[model samples]
Target: MSKSPIHPVSSLDRQSELENSPAQLISLDRVSFGYSHKRLVLQDLDLEIKQGEFLTLLGPSGCGKSTILNLIAGFYKPLLGRVTHGGEDIKGPSARRGVVFQSNALFDWMTVEQNVGFGFRFQAVSKHERKKRVETIIALVGLRGNERKYPYQLSGGMRQRVAVARSMVVQPEILLMDEPFAAVDVQTREGLQEELLKLHEQVSGAILFVTHSIEEAVFLSDRIVILDRNLGGIAHDIKIHLPEPRYTAMNRVSDAFNQYRTDLYLKMKAIE
Candidate 1:
């Protein structure tokens, strides 16, 4: 059988591409963090997220994946090293970096449009501008007719869509997603994944996604980083090279797909 047309660029080529690409949006250099200094959750970590890159963190639970996200989000300051955005220290969360959790995190009392436009209202943006932004994002996320529906009235997938619209409506520079599709059923998860890819194309902002599913990582990531549970550091950094319009079902079962999955599975298992 022919190899899947998806081909990963050579390491040298990747390095050149990165060097020529946009500057890093987020960087973690020699970082260490933990609830108590005695037990470091992440140690000597160094990472860079370039603009328009889809980077995924994959590891066993409790390997400090979420901790890394928290650090980048500025929820926790690093015990050592620095977390920087655009070469300056990350002081705290900002609209420049929007976050989406596994839970939809939508306001129950607000309608879909209300929830999406919440940020603008708080900033006292003009009413017309808020409505235009909210409506554009609603249509982008495929939630047009349900603008007035409350969170409780929507399905799990629909609620998640609302959450995404809320984040993107502000045009953030980076999106942080923590297992945002974990709660949905298999079919729903697949659909959300496709939707997210479409949304990424429209926004073109950097993404940092955390997930335990190897399949999920393979499907959505442009680059996958595996954390070593024992050492609390990076175990593997793998780049995905897949054809454009990556959703064809055949791509999931292609030789290249299985190879990527098998390679990651073995690496993760060895860590265990």
Candidate 2:
């Protein structure tokens, strides 16, 4: 990975590099959406996600954080815009985009292994092969021994981990997550954030993570996009620009951390 450029303009140059340097993976152009013609949630929004970049959409509750994820996932067609993957328009859902909802969405009756294997069920793969992939993801998510357990048998964090494994078992080109860590306790949330940072480092894919926590966004995302309701589009596309090998707690009191956090805090307060 290249060192983060010192000046803010360097971040904009990074966007130019991704757009013109033949590495762009996903692009959203003039994307606008409204469910019932009442009001536009996203208005004239455009974003480019380069390959292997981690981007976070942070906003207050009901401010279209998840709506952006849905638009990318092809869950809803934009009222007046385009969603493209690899330069081609994304018209509907595809296995290439693995989505992990805020809810665990685990089947209560199925074993964890069975739930993870569900990703490949529609592909007509052999049962043995499906079991093998599920087993690998089970280990990947740190749930190897708990494979036979049901969702009810696991802790909230464990269940969320399993949900992650299920989404990633398909080896998607992009992982679209909607506040996956919201329901956990603060301690568990922090630990899970660390776990995600490690997993993201090891794995290479474009990740669009939605969260309300600026701290989490600072630690996890390559770039943080703040959605503003009044602006009706992305109000801020802030780069984290931190040193490599970032950890959750080491820079909690750093000036850079406080600066970034305070800016986002003010933005949130303005929204309220």
Candidate 3:
């Protein structure tokens, strides 16, 4: 298999690059947020997601991993500091950033093609173009023949595939996934992970994923950030180094993959 075009950068190297690189796609500068004034879930947090990189946020429950993703998605306003995309404030959700929720979020009434092509309904793309785009994305996600099927008829994994295709069909600059595969069985989740990696390569967009699974995080991320609980902010930020074509079965049991998983496990254990 061909080697990955993008290699993971070391933490030190990443810091240096962050200081000088102009490729910062999304940024949270000293952002602080809370549901109630008495307690803050994230306080003065700072993070930068570079262009076309697969970055995952990992930590225990209540660590604000999902909160961070929501902030970037513009679902909530920061109590202090800012969330910016391409140097502009993110006032609200935009097509530039597509989001996949923990649930599949597919429309029960719509067929596979309609659900995947739903985004085009609001856009100005021509009918022929919309059909072409929808068909291509449906096929890309391996749902060609099932175009007429509804979400209720599909399996859990298949439903998630439609959800992914829906978000990706618009070609957003970044995709924010909040435990999107968490609802599936272990075997099915692995299949989705591999498919997601392949899609990421083809889409060439930045991905900011939030998950509690260490193995899943390591397997899919180019870089991983572990959040500290009780608004302690970020605890650890580590880069992953694994061979290209990470979907291969060997990667699951490989030495490098194990090392990263073990290290992350210990770090999260400490946080808990």
Candidate 4:
């Protein structure tokens, strides 16, 4: 697989290629994990996240959606099998895999500029390059003027943007988001979802997002995997076929979108 840069393209053009992509950036092979050995949260899970594809995990609570994210993030190890990245074992957290939590996790003491650029401090990048990258990502996330403001001064959406910018500034190969937009208002969450799709287009990295909203999963995902309760593993792995330019409001009301929503909603309700 070539590690070439992804040029900016329309969502319509990108969708076909993303679906056809053969590169597997992350793989979970026969993975089984439990916080306690008495009951496994995820069992015998085999999954693959392709490079540059946006894959969302959807399920009811305690279905191990976040547990799978944590395993890929290397926050926890699978007790029975292994999680691999680029064909190697993922022993621990690496800068190659970025994470965004439900909370923004920004430093209230640090300005937006400082927080976004913080990752560079441990890296070997020069001061000039660090500033350049930070400014570019901040602008990409639509936070150009609020560089000096602290997280306390920003709205929930804006602070989440900063968290996204912070994770994205380092250019991780795959971003693991554990319901990063779940805390915001409905209107703000919709806006953030649009912006996130735009960012994914520009950045061209794989995104593994965990969300409960079937609409959100349908809107943002190229594919969605639903986990079953009681460690039943993946119940349904569906390919989303919504019309391109998926960020628009029209796609939300389209027949294809609603059908997918209805199907997924029924599947989820059945799980509960």
Candidate 5:
């Protein structure tokens, strides 16, 4: 068990950043948003995702977990506050901020290689470089032999691999995932979780994940942020104390793992 290079931010420091211009990979300053003017799903939400950090947002239904991800991705704008990446305002979606949603979002007509290289095709990358890049990403996600297969031909897990490979091929600075493994079976979900940890070690970016599962949150995140639905703000911020090289064989069944899960479960229950 080795110590991982991840830290949880102090509440005081986090509060101070909203007012000061800090060095952050992504920053949300006093952000507030809702569909209609009558109700605000999130109010005055402040968060900072540092480089190379793995942060997860956990909350009950309708707590605006996905809303925060969308705001950072620039799919939706904040009504009152600001969302920025690298100290610049996020006006719209860009390839630099990659997103992976629950649905695979793969085109049924495109093969794995085509799906992975789609982003590069729009850029000035040559055909040879695009193919090389796609091959590398496919291998990274364990989809080497299935490059010729279409979305309908592969299983749920395989389709998700294609989605991940597609997003990663662009070489984004930040990766945002929303319940990416929620559709798979328990065994497959655990397998994907382990694969994701391995991928995180290889990739160089900050990850902001949204999930409703307590065990999933504890297993993957360096820091977990719990949101209270009624208050529309963060209720608890916890730093996971477990060591690195997380695996289902040893780390998942250890005493420390169970303790973190127990603590996070109680926190979620208390918020409800």
Candidate 6:
């Protein structure tokens, strides 16, 4: 049997090709992270996410994908490497980097609008401005009438939307999501995916989404990053040059989609 010609792109070459392009938004350069100087969760990683790009980090548990997210979110300090946002070193969390945690981090005591508007309560925004912000995000996340509703009043998916809305109300420069849809049911998850795509299209902010599901990664990302546990570094970084607004072919189940998913699955398994 003869082997088909593999794509002639090297990982580093692919990375350089992306970096040398005009749209690259964020870059992780020689990033090494650990609790101590020796104990490393992530070892010398370099990744570049383009502007308005939806990039998903896919790997198994303990593969340090979440650790990378934490580093990007400024929740954890990297012992050796630095995180840069648009060419500046990220010293700490900024409103520019919006964060969405796994659990619905909504304010139980606050209504949907209040929760979304809460960021402005301390800021200089006036009462009318706050209401406008809340209203804008409420509509964006499809939670219009639910503004008066509390966290308990909404479904799990709705709660997550509130979380998203709260994060988006401030209109950060980038969005960092850590398995945001993992807790929802399949149907709800699908809907949330669609909602996220719409939001991404409208907002056009760079997104770094972390998920274990290859399908979700394939469905949502402009590119996918797979980290291997052994080195706590990237195993595979694949560019998905599929056409814009992916949800239209969400269920296309094409040779390209399946091939991408299978390759991601295999890389994850190999890491294990």
Best by TM-score: 4
TM-score of each predicted structure versus truth = 0.91, 0.86, 0.92, 0.94, 0.90, 0.87
lDDT of 1 by residue, 1-272 (tens): 01112344453554456557867889999999988899888889999998767899999889998998888888899999999988999998888888998998999999998999987966767888888888888997888899989999999999999998898778677899999999999998988888887787667577899999999998887799999995469989988876666666666888888999999999999998
lDDT of each: 0.85, 0.79, 0.87, 0.89, 0.83, 0.79
Using TM-score, rank the candidates from best to worst.
4, 3, 1, 5, 6, 2
Model 4 spans > 4 angstroms off: 1-15
Query: Which ten residues in a row are the worst by lDDT in model 1?
Result: 1-10
How would you encode candidate 3's per-residue C-alpha lDDT over 1-272 as one tens digit per residue? 11133445453553444445568899999999998877899999999998877899998998899999999999999999999999999999999999999988889999998999899988999999999989887887888899999999999999999999999989888999999999999999998998898788677688999998999999998889999888888899887767766667778999989999889989989988
> What is the C-alpha lDDT profile of model 6 across 1-109, one tens digit per residue?
0111123443355345445668656778888887887777788889877766678998878778888888888888777767888888888888888999889788899
> Per-residue lDDT of 91-161 in model 2, one digit per residue for the tens?
88998888988888888999998888887988878888888878876886688899889999999999999
Tens digits of per-residue lDDT for model 5, 60-96: 9999999999999999999988999989999999999
> TM-score of the candidate numbered 1?
0.91
Give the per-residue lDDT digits (tens) of candidate 4, residues 1-272.
32235454554556667667778899999999997888889899999999988899998899999999999999999999989999999999999999998998998999999999988988999999999999998998889999999999999999999999999889899999999999999999998998897788677589999998999999999899999998888999998876656678998899989999999999999999
lDDT at position 78, candidate 6: 74
Of 2 and 5, the candidate ranking higher by TM-score: 5
RMSD (CA, angstroms), candidate 2: 4.7
Cα lDDT of model 2 overall?
0.79
| Candidate number that wins on lDDT, 2 or 4 | 4
Ranking by lDDT: 4, 3, 1, 5, 2, 6
